[model samples]
Target: MRANKYEEVWTRIMFEKIEVLSNKTAITRTEMKQGVITLVKGLNAYFNKEISAQNDAEYINKVWNNFHLCEITMNLIGSLTPKELMEIFPIEKIYDGKKYQTKDWFSAHEAVQQLAQETPISESKEVFDFLWDYHNWDLHIFTVNVIASMNNINKMEKGRGLLEQFLEEQGVRTINKMDMIDVNWEEERDGE
Candidate 1:
């Protein structure tokens, strides 16, 4: 899958695979819950030290947005059937100056109606499915193998591609379930 640049190939692969899965499952309540838990856990594990009690909510919300796409992905994996998945994932919470309410993730009719709205929608559910499935803990056994390989690498960026290749070679394509960890720094200090 060569391209004009390395990023193009990676992005294409990410988007195409995700789009297929997104079409399969739109969004539901259960998936939304799973996405929220995933976001909390991921932030806790990845950026725990950076957040304090005083700003936990704000930090978590920021992190959540960063992984909003991830939540969509997680929902796809947790709920296999689109219909079932839709029941699992909820529309995002929206606030209008005062109160907050859940918005619909699969608003086919409203989507059309709001097509010209100021805020454009990009099929996030699709992108989310890819990231979530790619890191699924149940179905993707290669996730285990990749975690083991992490022990030998100095940084995630340096090890991520190799781990993916190794897992692919071992016949692991979907990351439906897995978990593991290795020693890493609390932060990356530039010029180190």
Candidate 2:
């Protein structure tokens, strides 16, 4: 399949998984836990099949890296409370007695950085190191978007079109295009 088609399939699968979790009338901790496990297993199998079919080493490497990243991320999602998830993945920009910096919206990257720094000899630090090394900001945004949908912070759409639309918006487009431009979040936050 073409890249776009692959993305469509993946997005549909993700939406289906999230729907199963979110459609519950009163989701218990056990249900959430089982849902997360199922999600991880499903994703692992899907990506493994995709990875095995690839011929290019570079493409395989990219998918492999992404798979591990998603694995770690889903584990984190399962462990965190709704309140904590909300704090890390706020749907809109937030004010903290100052201007709204990009960092304040979907701040999981920053949170992970802080966690990695604060706990040098812990599993969080290890996970943070791996994520930082293969850091794809788009993935971070997508994960937060998923969490927001699951928690009813945002309504789940049918496919990846909404996410692509979001990424194409002016502000987000600029952020996604930048390399070193906005990497220094602390300076950006201070200047804002």
Candidate 3:
């Protein structure tokens, strides 16, 4: 299964860090930004093409897997607030025809519902059109992916100490649950 852009970016960042550490070299800010931009561009291009095709069974399956992966990630990190969502996917940029007004609300769900009601998909043909436009979509995806990558990196750093402690307690060099099943199967077969 393929990971969402966030995870993909996070993995790329981690690998970059490892390379820097091994080489004892520092990465420039511009270099990091350029790398991220490249990755975002590539991902956006691939997703846009797949989404446009829409009828490819393999792409559809990948999309479903990506959806589930994103759902799990969101569950772990908690949902973004309505305000945050708006910041990432600004209504002004998305739809230029009519301004859709939204009010502040205590509940994120209610706020999202109000926003949805204000900008119904049926009324916003331009929304789909804008999304289909590669240049616009690429820029939007780049911004979102960058934000998600930073957020994931922060969260992973925060949890790193605990993960290390857990590994120490477990007395294992690495935790590979999938390999454990294979090991068990081999032992069972030997016994049989």
| Full-model lDDT, candidate 3 | 0.40
Worst 10 residues of 2 by lDDT: 151-160
- Deviation from native of the Cα of residue 140 in model 3, angstroms: 9.0
lDDT of 2: 0.46
- Comparing candidate 1 with candidate 2, which one achieves the higher lDDT? 2
Model 2 clash pairs?
none
Which one wins on TM-score? 2
- Could you tell me which 10 consecutive residues in candidate 3 have the lowest summed lDDT? 126-135
Candidate 2 lDDT, 85-121, residue by residue in tens: 3344333434341254434433543555455332222
Stretches > 4 Å off in candidate 1: 1-6, 13-63, 81-192
Give the Å error, residue 65, model 3: 2.6
Evaluated against the true structure, the overall lDDT of model 1 is 0.38
Q: After superposition, how far is residue 64 of candidate 2 from its true place, in Å?
A: 15
List candidate 3 segments past 4 Å from native.
1-46, 49-64, 70-78, 93-192
- Give the alpha-carbon lDDT of every model: 0.38, 0.46, 0.40
Candidate 3: lDDT of 127? 34
